[model samples]
Target: MPRKSNTDVLALFDTLVYTCQYRLVLEPASHVSARVLEWRQGLRERIGLFHESYHMPSIILCSTELPPEYERSLVDAIARGSEGFASFNMNIGGVQHSEDKRTIYLEVGEKGIIAALRQRVVDHVRTNRRIKKLGVEVVDHARLVIASGLKADQFNAAWAMLAVQSVMVQQKVSDVVLIKRELGDTSMDEHVRTFALTQGV
Candidate 1:
């Protein structure tokens, strides 16, 4: 094979499609995160082989795809939407499977707050022409996925073990974080900004 020249490499790079995806998520407090990690480790020990280290434990608010130029506007919209939002406690516990029984996750009981916040953020971002055209998807269920990509038997085994156990944790959500990832990138999410929630007056 002939060695590729700089010009050829540059051309190939230019031809590649790069899609910028943005997501807004609620990151649990530090202590809450530690407990979740411990629970996950214990689950792995009991269940045998599984791989899901890349997944972050968070309540996804909204997800969308837009051009790089619109990112600044997106951040501004998120900030404005989340301004003066009150902090609340979310109950994260119980093991359940998706309708297809292909995913296992911890249930987030309080849906009111999540829905309200999602609406606020999406409302703000919808003002942008490009964003409106692309459309943003609001995450309906606020659950922390512990394990995914399971076969029928794997799902059954994991659920059978986890469902019987008592697992409950309280996460005090104080802020929401904005994260972004480039198309085809396998690395962890890059943090763009954090919007702090305000205490009730």
Candidate 2:
């Protein structure tokens, strides 16, 4: 018997179609928590993993591809929606493994600040005619993780048994980062076009 293909399995499931262009997320600053830094460093050492330009602990707001003509409109809408927002607090929860067990992450405990911010962004995007049909789902607890993709499950299992405890900490989210699409870049590229939260401060 042959092994099943990932594509074959994926084909059995419904997936969204849009060129991956932009993502809205929160990248915590270094001062957020000593433990988070320690965990990041430890993961780097133990799994030989490190944060890439795109890899940051984040709370995702919106991720979708829009028509090229609508790009500026989308950007403007995000800017307007996020204009009056200010920094807010969030708490880290413990470890969580995805249903596929293909990823492991630190769960974010529910808090009013993050929820409100997510709602604002969602509302703005949903009302926009350009990408309103895309349908967005705000993850209740932000996922802060050590690793993901092919080897995430292996690392997660090993780390869990290693006696290194995960921490629950609080951090202030001060920025809403926008990662934009770039020419000649694959959908995976992390070319950031703007970090919009500065204007709000």
The global C-alpha lDDT for each of the candidates, from Candidate 1 onward, is: 0.76, 0.60
Best by lDDT: 1
**Runs in model 2 lying further than 4 Å from the true structure:** 1-18, 31-54, 134-137, 149-168, 181-201
* lDDT of candidate model 2 versus the reference: 0.60
Q: Candidate 2: give the clashing pairs.
A: none
User: Which residue pairs collide, candidate 1?
Assistant: none
The most accurate candidate by TM-score is 1
- TM agreement with the true structure for every prediction: 0.76, 0.62
Q: Give candidate 1 regions above 4 Å deviation.
A: 1-17, 35-53
Cα deviation at 10, candidate 1, in Å, is: 22
Question: Across residues 1-201, which tens digit of lDDT does each residue of candidate 1 receive?
Answer: 999999899667545636577889987656656656665676667665454444456667888876677789999999899998898888887777799987787788779988898888889989887678667988888877777777788787778766775567786778899987765424456788999988655
